[model samples]
Target: MNLGLTPSVACVKPKPEDSFAISFAPLSVEDVYAKADDPANGAVVVMSGMVRNQTEGKPVVALEYQAYEPMAMQVFYQIAAEIRQKWSIVTRVVIYHRIGRLQVGEISVLVAVGCPHRSEAFEACRYAIDTLKHNAPIWKKEHWADGSSSWVSIGACETQGC
Candidate 1:
């Protein structure tokens, strides 16, 4: 079922063994991992991107994320599909991205990959995140304590403390 969700987000649970568990809201880091947890899969990899307290020597109080929801969701699916194609042993994949304001230390994105072995799981997880950062239509704005904000590309940030 599609859940009739906003086109900006994709929350699809295709199947327990092979699925792209995607979401575009405040995400539970633990839940993202759980989606890939299975006895049949011997290895599971999890990655979480969080909002930090500082960026480029400036004190960042919070972050505001915006996305072209429909395109972002499509990118998530594409990443997961690519993983499945390259790693046939992969049992599951979950990619969750958050939007709107996020406080320091809050999770902004999560990628979990499950496979029959540790190496494949790790590789798939890494590829999923890297691809998302480069391909996803998501943008972030750093909110500094000095009452300033700047739009930054996800993978092109030059901040020292980001």
Candidate 2:
């Protein structure tokens, strides 16, 4: 877990057996939601983004994801910062997004937010995903049946369900 936390920001201490749980992984939901049992985090909001097998009514074979690492990390930090600034009650926020080849139903991204209040957690969680879609510099290539692949250049405005 490359938690790039700086001294300027609040240092996140590993939850003491009861704080909160948030995760993203290529494995399974069990691995991702291991912290759900934390008692301190009363509310847990989980969001999973999956790769669809079909695109534009076409039969998709596979997908390849690419990301500009530096920019993507910046964007991820920005989203987390925005969520914290916008909400006063968000306790813990976890987001995991993958960059590589993917098949249908593969989990592309996962976000989880824990807070004392359910409303704040929900708002922050949703905001994180929406912002990531709009800001992350990640691209995808769709493979078709005939061995042709096309890139999906998702701009900030277009990706946020705009």
Candidate 3:
């Protein structure tokens, strides 16, 4: 069987044991980099997403995350396979996403990819996030200080402000 990444990317919510460290609170770039380190890993690229206070000019109080665990896992595995097959330089990659209660200024997700060179690492890491956003089942619920909240769906406009 070929252990190669597919042309299309998939996203998953990795198990804690399979991940460097998985938590609902926040993610750390340093932690991801530390786990991604290896003798064979010459280059490491890291991406961190922070919870912004505003979306479309509105203030966000807090956020809740939910996911479809089984599908999420499947997507993640496919992503790993695809990356391995497409990129010769990339050796390993780690993607950590938080699903649960999260506050502002907290890390929502982290992606780290290691390769033989910086370019490959960067490409793989970037691809991971973009694909995850497109394919993952993770959803966000934004709470407002005015005693109101709304479930923010993926692909929705939450960039303005919460």
Candidate 4:
């Protein structure tokens, strides 16, 4: 019955350093990067979401973000767990999202992933941000230059490419 088979040893992965926060203050790329930094990491990829000056050709004056804090934080943790499952080599995951009114060019969110390789770090970082955008209980209000304001749906991001 044995066909030259050997019992595979179970690989034990180190506990990944994960940080998640729902903040009212501004998000800093350097801060998140530092959180995701690990001695075992060869690369740390960071994605920073910012308040753009325009949306769908409309001039945007500012954006106001709101979130269900408790649930959003839970979702952030879930995202990190998912990343670990998908990329076992991931050393750390850091996600920070800012709420409140923000002017154009301001940072809104930061997602960073540390891994032993550049490709996995980049992929894991991208997954964190994209999943957060769709799954987190967060909302945004866009203020137009014409003094009109509209609340945006999270689903709109998929269709309108927001």
Candidate 5:
């Protein structure tokens, strides 16, 4: 049976071992890792995206995140499906993203992949985050120390070295 939020994609049922969510509360690495943990897997690789203190040499105080929730959740399911297609040994996939203002050092996103081998786990986890960054309908505003703020596009990672 599928769990977590329902996928907006038609005819696509998310696996019971796979989970996705967009939350306003602070994300926890331990909780995300546990969600991806499985006895059938030897490795669970997790990638935690945190709000950092600086960006492009500018001091940052906090970040505000927003998402088109339905679409973002659909993209999360697509990412997990792609991972499973690429790594058949993958046992679980868990993705969580935070929305609202987040202070520096706070977790913003977490992507975890469980696989029987470390290599596949790492590769799948990397793929999940990269895909999410590029495809998810999520946006973030950087709150600068200078009392300024600006919305950053998803492609900002490519041009701004994020």
Candidate 6:
């Protein structure tokens, strides 16, 4: 947990009705944003991860995301707890990541956090997305316009569990 992430502790999958969530079916960022909105919480930060048209100057046609759902769901819950512990003002955290072929400009994932103030909301929101990218059980495969395909693991995992 040195990297400001939650320790990988065993926990039940976060419930559908819980503040922590992960959805595979394409869910709207606006919907997740609405769920995190609260008059009591002055700040609501939403992070949207989109499939870009290129990577490192290489033209990308699409990306396919696949994950071990059980493990990924566990990590997502752990991240939510970590955010709450680090920033007690955070009232809600919602994450939605898509698994399948995604075209350019399509949203690949979304993370939203509600907090009493802007600072905590921003910090916790960034932490959730960064940690998920670094530690989740998801894998991304890039499809190039030239018909080349490659599985790219996150840099943080490339030297470890990968």
lDDT of each: 0.79, 0.67, 0.71, 0.84, 0.88, 0.82
Measured against the true structure, the TM-scores of the candidates, in listed sequence, are 0.81, 0.74, 0.79, 0.85, 0.88, 0.87
Give Cα distance to truth, residue 18, candidate 4, Å.
0.9
Q: lDDT: which is higher, 2 or 6? A: 6
**Leading candidate by TM-score:** 5
Candidate rank order under TM-score: 5, 6, 4, 1, 3, 2
Off by over 4 Å in 2: 1-28, 35-38, 155-162
What is the alpha-carbon lDDT of model 1 when measured against the actual structure?
Answer: 0.79
Give the residue spans of candidate 6 off by over 4 A.
1-9, 12-24, 155-159
Tens-digit lDDT track of model 4 for 75-141 = 7887888899999999999989889999999999999999999999999999988888887778899
**Candidate 5 — worst ten consecutive residues by lDDT sum?**
153-162
The TM-score that candidate 1 achieves is 0.81
After superposing candidate 3, which stretches have Cα over 4 Å from the reference?
1-22, 155-162
Worst 10 residues of 2 by lDDT: 15-24
lDDT of 1 by residue, 1-162 (tens): 887755433554344354443344678867877888888789889998999999978999999888776666677777777788899888888888888889999899888998889999999999999988877777789999999999887732222122
Error of 3 at 33 (Å): 1.0
**In what order do the candidates fall by lDDT, top score first?**
5, 4, 6, 1, 3, 2
Off by over 4 Å in 1: 1-25, 155-162
| Candidate closest to the true structure, highest lDDT | 5
lDDT of 5 by residue, 88-117 (tens): 999999999999999999999999999999
Q: Report backbone clashes per prediction.
A: 2, 0, 18, 0, 0, 0
